[model samples]
Target: MLISNIEVIPGKRITDHLGLVQGSTVRAKHAGKDLMAGLKNIFGGELQGYTELLQESRQEAVDRMIVQAQAIGANAIINVRFSTSAIAAGASEILAYGTAVRLNDR
Candidate 1:
């Protein structure tokens, strides 16, 4: 399925609006990874572990959103958006949302 941040897709016409779809996930920092991140913080360098965690979380959220869209027979998703929030001291929630639509070649 085609996905984009823009409301309109070039060379494609929106044939049906399937409504809004969303997916989200919550994740916490692993103790081992957190310890490594803390050590890296002392050296004032990038926390690869934390970075990887967030990236993976984001992808999972997006994938879930796509599954929802597909289940509703949507061929594409437009105006895709992502949000992140701290759920707790060590946990964070990631969300992905978009308008599901059926498209046809113009």
Candidate 2:
């Protein structure tokens, strides 16, 4: 399925709006990674561990969102967006959402 951050797809017409589709995952920080991150913080460098975790979680959320879209018979997803919220001291939730739609070339 095609996914885009834009509200509308150029050269394509949305034939049907299947409503909102969303998926989310909550992840907690690993102790070892957190320790490493704390050390890196002193030097003000990138936190690779957290970055990787977020990337993986984001992809998972997107994948699940696609599954939801497919269940609704959507050919594509438009206005795709992501959001995150802190779930706990060391855990966070990642969410992917979009409008499920049937699209046709215009």
Candidate 3:
């Protein structure tokens, strides 16, 4: 299914609105990675571990969102968005949401 951050996809028309679709995943930080991140913090460098984790989470969430859209018979998802939040002391949740729709060719 097609997904876009824009409210509308150029050259495509929204033929049907299938309401809101969303997917989320919760992940915990690894102790070893956290330690490495802490060390990097001193030098103000990128935390590769967390970066990888978030990237994976984002993809997972987006995949789930696509599943939901497919279930609803949607051909595309518009106004896609992602959100991150701390679910617990060591866990974080990533959410993907969008409006499911049936698209018509131009």
Per-model lDDT: 0.95, 0.95, 0.93
Off by over 4 Å in 1: none
Tell me the tens digit of each residue's lDDT in model 3 across 1-106. Answer: 8889999899988889999999999999999999998899899978889999999989999999999999989999999989999979989999999999999998
Question: Tens digits of per-residue lDDT for model 2 on 26-101?
Answer: 9999999999998998999789899999999999999999999999899999999899999799999999999999
lDDT digits (tens) for residues 1-106 of candidate 1: 9999999999999999999999999999999998998888789988888889999999999999999999999999999999999979999999999999999999
Ten-residue segment with the worst summed lDDT in candidate 3?
37-46
TM-score of model 2 vs. true structure:
0.95
Please give the ranking of all candidate structures by lDDT, highest first, separated by commas. Answer: 1, 2, 3
Model 2 clash pairs? none
| Candidate 2 accuracy as lDDT | 0.95
Q: Model 3: clashing residue pairs?
A: none
Count of steric clashes across candidates, in order: 0, 0, 0
